[model samples]
Target: MALLDADARHPITLPDGTLYRDTVYLKNVIDHPRIKVGDFSYYTHSGKPEDTAAILAPYLGHSVRERLVIGKFVQIARGSYFITSSANHPMTGFTTYPFRIFKPETFGYKDLPVRDTVVEHDVWIGHNAAIMPGVRIGTGAIVAAASVVARDVPPYAVVGGNPASLIRMRYSDDIISELLSIAWWDWSLDKIEANLDALTLGDMEALRRA
Candidate 1:
């Protein structure tokens, strides 16, 4: 059997052979029009599989202008959720109160500028993290547990806190550039499996060779 199955909704299996229902491949489970998820991107949540999209991104409604773009191999821990553009109240007005929402006919703040929320490949978002609207979390970034990320996180950075700040970069700029150029995440599963040592170990030479 293959190590990974993209088609499986419940992808993880315990040592005793029971399917781990809490984790699901986001692409397979999510059917929202405004959200785009790549292969192997998984989210751990207690909600039903059918409600995975809503659970992960509660504010991203079907007709919303903004999008939630998540790339391949993203690891989203339990209790993490996205606050998309639709959730924002009108900040331009004198007050933040959404008076238009009281009436169904005039229920939208369409004039507000909307921006898409993007999470790039191989990003790890920890438990109870809140990703703010329009934030772009770069590839290989690590968002610490219980963080409220209001700003963009650079690639390979470790960020944490209420308004998440950069803790440190995982690698030097040169190495990060090299890895981004390599883009191992784009490789086929067979190729990736063959170069597991290079991927798991910090072996740049081996990775280049692979």
Candidate 2:
């Protein structure tokens, strides 16, 4: 039962208006080797494992039993939504309130796809963006705030919109390729912590050259 504070932001506060000198809610969901969840990185529906599984699925959902999968250095912000399994109503009841029935196939229900979501290394997703199932936001990519991403995003691209369209590339393809080659996130935590100052303000090439 050890967990990490997603951030070293402020004095820890529990959900019930009760203040704790040292505690947090993210400790249990964090079990990754390379990724660090900044204190502000949050799950919209923290109470539902099914939802967190879909949102963090890229990092934690694999092993057959677990359904999330995430890569190194992913930065998820508050108000960002990650989806795993979806709730559906029955078929013939489309006009009714109960959403048809549990199993549409029981009445020839069409199966809806369960898509896995992934945010790769060094990726920065802005606040309030909603990433849908089966979407892979690639390494080094940036998704702008309030975007509704519904498909796979390529690496190093900047995307924003209601349904998330690629705005443009943040850097030349060559530079991105070089950064990919450098792979700084794969370095040991000690190395990164030691060079944190340099890594935060500069480019990957600078780190490699250093």
Instruction: Give Cα-based local distance difference scores for all models.
Output: 0.95, 0.60
The stretch of ten residues in a row with the least summed lDDT in candidate 2 is 1-10
lDDT of 2 by residue, 144-210 (tens): 9989888899999999998999999988888788778877777666666666767778656458765
Q: Count of backbone clashes for each model? A: 0, 20
Candidate 1 lDDT over 53-141, as tens digits, reads: 99999988899899999999999999999999999999886999999989988887888899999999999999999999999999999
lDDT of 2 at 107: 31
Instruction: Show model 1 residue runs off by greater than 4 Å.
Output: none
Kindly report which residue stretches of model 2 are placed more than 4 angstroms away from their true locations once superposed: 1-27, 30-66, 85-111
Models 1 onward score TM values of 0.98, 0.63
TM-score of 2: 0.63
Which candidate comes out best when scored by TM-score?
Answer: 1
